[model samples]
Target: MSDVAALLSLARAAKARIATAESCTGGMLSAALTDVAGSSDVFDRGFVTYSNAAKQAMLGVSPETLARVGAVSEEVAREMAEGALARSEATLAVAVTGIAGPGGSEFKPEGRVCFGLARRGQPTQVETVEFGALGRAGVRQATVAHALRLLAEALG
Candidate 1:
């Protein structure tokens, strides 16, 4: 069984639910969590906000945050996590934003991923990871894995 499945099982045992807000990794994180049997008890919903406007409209991410930090920054990720928690019954929410690309830029290069986690009545936690030069698919997969781990940690 995948670690995500185990994490979901733990969450179910604790009577806690999780929600996901994803970008770059798309809905893969949600897919992974729900892939396990009986995940419906633990996973509440998922948001696939690939665009800044979508993030704002769907998760209540601020336009100011997007303009200040871009779509793939810690601010946006935190806002996404907070919004997901506010919008769902889930006790924990995870958000991912990044540029998983084959092309690199001087500032936000390829394989740059940011993650955020929000818990009920708690401050949102945000972090950034750079996978260096991994290709698009690899970076995305890694981001999904990291997001799952973050969700598990938040659940605990």
Candidate 2:
């Protein structure tokens, strides 16, 4: 089984449901999870909040966090995950934000990603990663893979 398939197995065994909040990956994590058969049993819902305003309006991300961290930081990702968990009835949630781009900025640059995972009754975990200057598709694929791995880890 693929690791994602394994994650579904774990979640099913634990009777847990998961949700996702996505930005740069644009619901890719949710797409991947739902690509598997029987995912509806373990997957709850997904949010695609590509804009800072949508992040605030939909996922309850603070405008202050967006202003301070520029929508692609660990703080926003954490808030997205927590908000997804709170908004959905899922037991676990994952969120991602990044610049999967051929264009962006000097300091943040391309291929910079942030991730967050929240499980009900547990403190949320957040991390930031730089995949350097990969091609846009490559960076997005890597981000989805990494997010799936984090989801599997969280379920365990």
Candidate 3:
């Protein structure tokens, strides 16, 4: 089975609801999770916070955190996950933020994605991965895959 299917199976078994907070990948991660049959049993909601304003307004991502580390940083990703969990009735949340593009800076290159996972009664987990110059679509697909894995890991 696909990663998302496995995650939904595990979540349903555990009676866990999941949410997604997405930035660079837009709602792709959410789309992937919901694509499976009967995902409504485990999927709760999704936040497509592509802009800094949306991130702050929707996910409660701190403006200071964005100004300090930018939207693609680990700090913002963690806050996004935590905020999703807070704003929804979900037991678990995953956040993705990154620059998936043909354009990137020397410091924050393209395909550098930050992920955060928050589970009820558990500490939030944050990670940064470098997929190394993958095109925009490629990076987004990879991010969705990684996000699914993160959610599955958290369910465990």
Candidate 4:
């Protein structure tokens, strides 16, 4: 699951294309996926929705949802994943939103990330990972790693 090449191969074998919707990690998930050679067939596209406006405009994340639970919540992550899957030609999509930061409140701590995985004709799943104060770079790197795992698991 940590191996990007193996994950890509799994997707290709399943004929599953991938799309990503990222917030705190920016486009790091997309970069990780495309880092491997011959990923074009399985990696479809990515949306770096770093802002509330961008999330609404690009991924169709509901303004109401954002206002209700904020961008870092499971609701927003779920919407982002579903939105990405609906907007792309890909069969599978993953979304992430969180506070990978040097600043965070008690409600949402630093290194707290929410992930959503959506596959065609299947129920979308969401989970929260409290990576714990792993500095900014560490949180982001961990996010990309976990995202790769999510993609690999989704292939099954």
Best by lDDT: 4
Counted clashes in each candidate structure? 0, 0, 0, 0
Cα deviation of 103, candidate 2, in Å? 2.3
Clashes of 2: 0
Worst 10 residues of 3 by lDDT: 147-156
Residue 110 alpha-carbon offset, candidate 3, angstroms? 0.4
Model 1 Cα lDDT, one tens digit per residue, 14-105? 78889999989889989988888888888899999998888999999999888887988899989999999999999999999998898868
lDDT of 3: 0.93
The residue pairs in collision within model 1 are none
Candidates in order have lDDT scores of 0.89, 0.92, 0.93, 0.94
| Tens-digit per-residue lDDT, 1-156, candidate 2 | 988899999999899999999999988889999999989999999999999989999999999888987898889999999999999989999999999999779888899999999999999999998987788998999999999889878778
Q: Residue 141 of candidate 2: its Cα lDDT?
A: 96
What TM-score does prediction 2 earn? 0.97
Residue pairs with backbone overlap in model 2: none
TM-score for each prediction? 0.96, 0.97, 0.97, 0.97
Alpha-carbon shift of residue 110 in model 4 (angstroms) = 0.3
Kindly report which residue stretches of model 4 are placed more than 4 angstroms away from their true locations once superposed.
Answer: none
Comparing 2 with 4 on lDDT, the higher-scoring candidate is 4
lDDT against true structure, model 1: 0.89
